[model samples]
Target: MKLAPLHAAKAAIESMSGDQVLHTVDGHAFIPMDDVWVVATPSGPASFNFNNLPGASPELRQQIKDVCRALLVSAAPSRASQALTAYRVLIRFLAEEMPGRAVEMISLRDVLRYGASLKAKELYKLRRLKEHLLLWVDLGIGGLDDDLLIRLPDLETKHHEVGAAVRTLDPETGPLTDMEYENLLSAIRNAFTEGKLTTSNYTLLMLAITLGARPLQLAMLKCGDFTVSARQDNSKIFILQVTRIKQGKGIRPRTIFRPRELAPALGTLIQQQCDEAREWAVAHDVAPEVAPIFLSDRSSINMGDIGLRGHHSGKSMAEKLRRLLKDLAVTSHRTGRKLHLFQSRIRRTLGTRAAAEGHSASVIADLLDHSWIDSSLIYVETRPAMMERIDKALALQLAPVAQAFAGTLVMRQDTDRGRIIHTATRSQLESVGTCGKHDYCRLAAPLACYTCTFFNPWLDAPHESLLDSLLQEREILANTADLRIAAVNDLTILAVADLVRKCGEMVGRATK
Candidate 1:
């Protein structure tokens, strides 16, 4: 940016004496001098408290705010809070060590000392500090001087080995083993079906897990975006137009959106959610316009009580996901710990799954709606080796921990529960279990039942044969295609292993 325009903006900022609302290029407004600046952003209202930077002078606050205005005007709302965070760290650094000193008093030595003081893990923080210092110099705001400018270009030339994406490398972080994702997805469905998760939340979780859409994009979803497109494969295709963010300046943000296809069931659920959002808007006396799908209902899902746009912030989505995960407390067989759930983890898992399915970086980028392929390069680089070694002992060991089999054991010699849960063996209807809670199950019989809690397996039935068949199928698929595709039924394999162990123990005890 030219210093002339920045100076003119600074001049305009300096002229504001009383409470003044500054409008961002993105159509959001905030008072620059407020104790807590509640900036209305597409994601939601982000609050940055100047009081958090204690013992800071009004002059320092004004300078920070003035410099940030250029950022707010040009960049996305998400960057605004981050810029504040970077500023706070610098000001706090000055206040602690350099007492009674203005920000301008810091020399190149002070800059070097501050840079050295930061831990390696806070490399991003150090970068942010260096960035703001440069901006301050260029914009003529007070922070650092020209002496450090010579070393600034050298910092860019420093050699460093790049690390793989943490989410892809760590099993605990996710690219969740197919089994783990299946279990969590099942758990979430159960939670929603059992009256735990509301329509808004249930739909949001589905979209996140299924599409890997960012929370910012999801938050920006309006009721109108959930529209039906042309028919494909004899089925009506539901298209969700997700608003794009961080697309860089000069590109119209929300005006340019990516259309993502939703599964029929999820599409139906989202349509239902849109209905609720409409009702909610009417109940709240909010004139029906383009409104957010996930309305702010942290208090209650009660009609007329839902908060309007920017209420259900991206933070709100993250918090909701956190609470849901905490409530479910789903344990991971891989780590024997509750899965560390995050939206980013889910997004990473989506990318990893695509990569494992032999997708290129460009394909992964399109899947992730990334403007550049560089962001998705990490997933394709790291091999998803979560399912390479799944022997019987390993399966048995993790089986109990996974709790993948939610079915009840049917030991009796009767089909009295509801219906016979049977699969084919040697061209015969071989009964394995009973669907105890059978109310016309839409799931694939026998295979899906093993993981369901409703299935009651006959104790002495051909469960071992079932296990053998699934393992054989898994091996066949792995040899021919991706291990990710082969590992789709891994949870069921664990279930069958757990069942096999139980059946053997029960049969032996009876013989004894």
Candidate 2:
């Protein structure tokens, strides 16, 4: 019999069941015969091949491959991919450090040596490598034993401490400063005004800033996810239902309340997306209901097209943000800074701002979708202005307690200032050291006294010279181009000016 066409044969084979067997001679048409048994060459099953590690023995490489195959079978696709990459990195590192040695024979000392070769920032990778190795041992894919666990360094501790320190000092990775944030918002508004930013990009960026949602969550949002309703008070409320991709146990969706100010832009953007999505569905011959709200520009017009995936990937969304930021010239306000325009940083900026606004850690954790409260603590710790406010509140709270021990705290009538009362303690006056004039101390006498914490001013005090001196000193500092000195002088000037203003008010009242 003549052979069937290649496409036809493939179709027939695909339609056949695993139990049913068909034989073909000379790779032609399949013929069925029940009387005699005939064997046919089976096409090999598709398999993944790990790259050969340099300087690794054949046996060790085979063992690594076996473990990775086990991972591919047992783990989820994303996890399996990560495991494969992590294993390859570990094997490559091991191949260089301990050439020709079996993984089972890898000692704690060898692991430590491998860790030492990696930079501090790569500790998380090392930790992942350890996790994979442990998984391989548990699954019995490799000769590694439980003993290998003993040798692995405490990556969790090292990573935590180092990460905290880095987050505290590393300006690039942390949240945007107030000035930088304002600049970014201004740039975004300018971009919208100029029609340079796409509706999808603008909506996503706004959502990121306001809701602090991850890029993936934003990308995966469907048309049905957005909802607008009228409140009982006749005001419109815009609510976005975000699907938690990295959820555990139950599918708990998050609700993001769009601010009233952003509602108009959000509503307009969403309407545009719905129109685009419907058009895309019609173009691609797909159901309009199934189309994503945040469709990618690269999406194809047909379902069979290789580029038919409509939604943007998390990575592509981040890339779009980076390009937009670059175009806007959104550089950091801090020195030696670059435009850090990733989703996580934007989210972090929101979280940090919330923390600064006196939101509790638990509330922030809930907002950020953190599984633990500790994750939110980093934002709280990094906000110094918030800490200063907290410190001031605490000092006020402790004031009465301190006053109880310091005898009767009262305002004393001053000889120089007539009938003025000041909040002061005898202890404060006795313990606090006297001020000395340095090159820094430009303010003279009564004006300088207002800047001192120990020098409590009375409203009745003679402040004519103090006010004039403070104004003169401020003028002198303002005239100079030394910003640092001027800043310090400005603070002192404001404090003294406030005291002088209060004295004048008291004098007016006394006359009245």
Candidate 3:
């Protein structure tokens, strides 16, 4: 039997009855021809021919085809796609570089030499080739020799090392900065306000920034996915329910809230989408129901002469976003690199902000719908703003204790309530009477004591002068102190001034 040319094999597969072909696990039909396999696609049958492989024998080629068939049947769609590409890459290498050499006879050294010949960008394909070969051996489809498996060089470690080095050396690529984010928001708002942006583009950009949903998630959203609730106060709450697409199996949907201020805009966009969907349905003589929110203007699928409209794909959404960014002239400040606003980056930015705002790891994971909390760590790691916020929070919490230790305030235990402490400095303790509710007061000492009716100021406590000093100090600190710590200083100043006022009253009463 003679092997047919690649085109002839493809044509033969195309002519075969679909019922006669074997179906992959994904339910796609495929037909085997000589030493090649052809899988049916929407466009037509795609051929995977190994007859021209440099070192592969007829038997080895059949084994490769068997593995391809197994993958198509068992692997997920993304993995199946990768396997197909890997098969083609391996065949190309064998046919062009190692002509006439049997694949099974090729040593580990030969594989290494082949890898060395590939450029950096093509290095990932070599990894995929090794992965497919290993899978084939594991599945016992190829009956590959043990020596071939043992000699297969471990390229993963080297690949990772090189990748890390490249990332470190070229660290210019990163998330948007504060100013850049503000500028982007401004540009988007201005464009939307000016009617320059379409309803679809405006809604997509706003949702990307506010909800941080994945492109596929946004594309998959339907008009019914959003629920708006009205409160008694007349304010409305918008909730968007997103279906997770990337997770392989059995993942629950996630719900996110839209900012209250965006409610009006979101409502308008939803109304517009529904109106368009209804118009399309009416034009096509189809009953209108809840349909895709982001409908594609161009139909990719044929429905006779009627032409069926479907939801926009992730690729299409990304392209639309890119065009918007290009029109806005958004660019990175650090490297002056042209900015490509990706959905993933928007998600990262939101995750980082959530972490900075003191949300827990579990909360971040839940918000992002990550399977593991560790995955959320990537967004929060080494962010200086988050660290600073944490530090400031810690400092504020400890401010009272620090003041007490420095002799600026005092703490006295209330035996009646073991946890309650009466706060007053040595001077205040001598001048003012002890607070009656000190046993119940949970507030920081001195300040709360000053405003209490139990407070009695000493006649010679120099109350007027103390009030002047406190007012001056408060004004100075208010002007110079960091905003984060200024509130703590303000509280102390208010407490001391109240104590001084009470003392002045007592002094005046003594003189009378």
For residues 1-512, could you state the per-residue lDDT of candidate 3 as single tens digits? Answer: 01122233334434665446655433455554445665532222345665644556667666666555555555433444455566556655655675655565444555566678787767765676786566655555443555766765444513322222112322233455443454466567556645788877887788778767776566656656666787899877665667664453212122332222346767767667767877776786655654667777753333111112355655566666667766865544334454556666666666765765567778877777666787676555534231112122242343332221111122233222222223333365333234443355454444444433333334344434444544555455556864333343333343344444444455577789
TM-score of each: 0.86, 0.57, 0.57
- TM-score: which is higher, 1 or 3? 1
Off by over 4 Å in 2: 1-49, 56-63, 98-112, 116-124, 149-157, 160-171, 233-235, 246-264, 299-308, 336-338, 386-512
In candidate 1, what are the lDDT values of residues 101-165, reduced to their tens digit?
Answer: 65544456765666777777655566666655665565676644467655653454222333345
lDDT of 2 by residue, 415-496 (tens): 2232222222324321211222222333354333444433545444433344454455545665773333333433334344
User: What is the model-wide C-alpha lDDT for candidate 3?
Assistant: 0.52
Colliding pairs, model 1? 406-453
> lDDT (CA) for every model shown?
0.72, 0.51, 0.52
Clashing pairs in 2: none
Give the distance in Å from residue 288's predicted Cα in candidate 2 to where it truly belongs: 2.9
Top lDDT prediction, candidate number? 1
Q: In angstroms, how far off is 58's CA in candidate 1?
A: 5.2
Q: Give the count of colliding residue pairs in each prediction.
A: 1, 0, 8
Per-model root-mean-square deviation over C-alphas:
3.9, 18.6, 16.9
Error of 1 at 136 (Å): 3.1
